[model samples]
Target: MFEQKATEWVNSYSDMLYRYALPRVSDSDVAKDLVQETFLAAWRNIKTFKGEISEKNWLFTILKNKIIDHYRKAVNRLTDSFPGMADDDPYFEEGGHWAKETQPKEWGVDYNNPIEAKEFYEVLEKCKSKLKEMQNAVFTMKYMEGMESEEICKELNITPSNYWVLLHRAKVQLRACLEKNWFVK
Candidate 1:
């Protein structure tokens, strides 16, 4: 009875679980792991889940715990991971709380004007040059490469705290630089 229930639960809830998990983890692999782990955990503890909560609520509660576990493990792994040059490094991982809430979208730049393009690139180049080496790298890795804090931390051999500080400073510097260089026009 327990096996049948667990199997049916998996069939019903796996997709729902993934919908929640994938957005948090961003990587399909990690999302899959989280979903599978959530189910296994639910299977083990399902009996303990009092009738006060519905099965969906209980499963989701378990999923939430699993997500938190991922965050804690990722934090621990990131804290300890250094000289970790693999492309798979968690440095740029997207699941951290520090990850951007808003994804970049097409902000229609009027690119038809050759002079405008040149001027824009020139201003950006000036802004780029003004940043400290680490700031420049972080900004490039973030804005250009679109890496998340987790991956950037791993890639740059820095902690999450360091990553966020660099990003904040980089944004401030770039904004000031752009205002000085470009907004004048």
Candidate 2:
């Protein structure tokens, strides 16, 4: 009976679960792991499954919690295992962090700038391609995906300050990268 219910749930939920998990985790492997863990958790807690929440909702809730828990555990392990790693160390920090605390150019954004959308997107792509792996990852999670720093830290197994520093460095690198790659012509 447990196997039957589990199979049925997997058949219906596999693709749906993947869709929900993929964008957040980015890697196909981790998304699959999350989905599998969600199921294992659900199977173990089947007796406690309350009818109040829809199965889909419950599964998703379980998956999200699992994701957060995964990050938390991973972060705790890393932090607990390592010590005296100064965040001030320049190794992880990248370009243009100085501008983050300031206002954008006083010239201001002109959304009506007549540039073609394609050209704009190409420029963005070019800039993104030049970013360091970590910079690009943080930028995607924060900007493209619209996640807040707190959530991103929780998900990526980083601290709030690390998130801010990453965001700052990403913006800086993006600026210099764009200027060098796109605007310097």
Candidate 3:
């Protein structure tokens, strides 16, 4: 009986689950795999499923954990220093002055227009893809996942000061990228 119900979930929830996972993981194949894994996990844990939360919410929670696990594995794959991060660092020069080329350009974003907002988010995702591994992890955790700073620090095993630095660097890089790409007239 439970197996039949779980199979039905695959038909109904797969599209919604795939859409949610795609943007978060930023890879279609991985997103699809994660959704599949989520369904499998739900099946394995079916005995524990309580009707308290909507089934949709339960599936989403499982997918969220799968995404986090992906990030954790990605973090382990990254080296202590990545080559692109240093060369791509736009915030400061070796002498500690701000980089002139990275100064933010004026963007004519019409926040009231849904179309412009959609465009902005598209560019933002591209910018996010360019972030350093650690910076990407920390930024997504705090902003995308809505995690607290303390929680991010604990999960990523970094100090509070380091978390702030990563977040600041992510913002600066993302802003510069957006200015150059989306804001260009």
Candidate 4:
């Protein structure tokens, strides 16, 4: 009976989980592995399943944790220092404003238009891929997952200041990438 139910869950939730994880991890194979891992975990803990939430939500919660774990592991494997985190950031000036040449330009795209938005997202993903691993994780957790600063700090095992610095660097890099690739083009 438990095996049957587990199969049912795999059939039902695998696609949704894959879609949820793909953009976050930015890799199809890793996303599939995470989904498989989520199912394996849910199966192992089947005895603890309660009716407090829908089965789908529970599976999603598991998948979300799996994604967070992926980020945590990637962060732990970092060997090189992030030069973008240095105190003398290139994007900002002495007074913490955008440097004269670094000021943002008008995107001039209709965000509500689905076609343009999709194209913009494709470009954004390319830009995101260029960010350092820690910056990508922090940026995704804070902006994509809408997680709080404290929660992100706890999850990534970084100090609050470090979290802020990573977030700032990610934004600066993303903005510059977009400006050059999307806005100017």
| lDDT string, candidate 4, 145-184, tens digits | 9999999999988888888889989998898998988788
The candidates, ranked best first by TM-score, are 3, 4, 2, 1
RMSD after CA superposition, every candidate: 13.8, 7.0, 2.7, 2.9
Worst 10 residues of 2 by lDDT: 82-91
Q: In model 2, which regions exceed 4 Å deviation?
A: 77-159, 170-185
Candidate 1 lDDT tens digits, 120-182: 776776676666555555666677547687876775567787677767766755665665566
Q: Across residues 1-185, which tens digit of lDDT does each residue of candidate 2 receive?
A: 86788789999998998877665555579879999999999888988987899998999889877765654554456634323223553323256254442323333336577556677656766676565445555677677657788778767777777677667766866666555545553
Off by over 4 Å in 3: 1-4, 82-88, 110-117
| Superposed model 4: Cα runs more than 4 Å off | 1-4, 79-84, 87-102, 110-116
Pitting candidate 1 against candidate 3, the one with the higher lDDT is 3
TM-score: model 4 vs. ground truth: 0.82
In candidate 2, which residue pairs get closer than 3 Å at backbone N, Cα or C atoms, i.e. clash?
A: none
Worst 10 residues of 1 by lDDT: 82-91
lDDT of 4 at 155: 91
Q: What would the per-residue lDDT of candidate 3 be over residues 1-185, giving only the tens digit for each residue? A: 86688678988999999988877776689999999999999888978998899999999999989988887777667667532345445578777678787656667766576554677788878888788767887888888889999988777677787778788888888888877877784
Cα lDDT listed for each candidate: 0.64, 0.67, 0.80, 0.85
Separate clash counts for every candidate: 10, 0, 0, 0
- Worst lDDT 10-window in candidate 3: 81-90
**Candidate topping TM-score:** 3
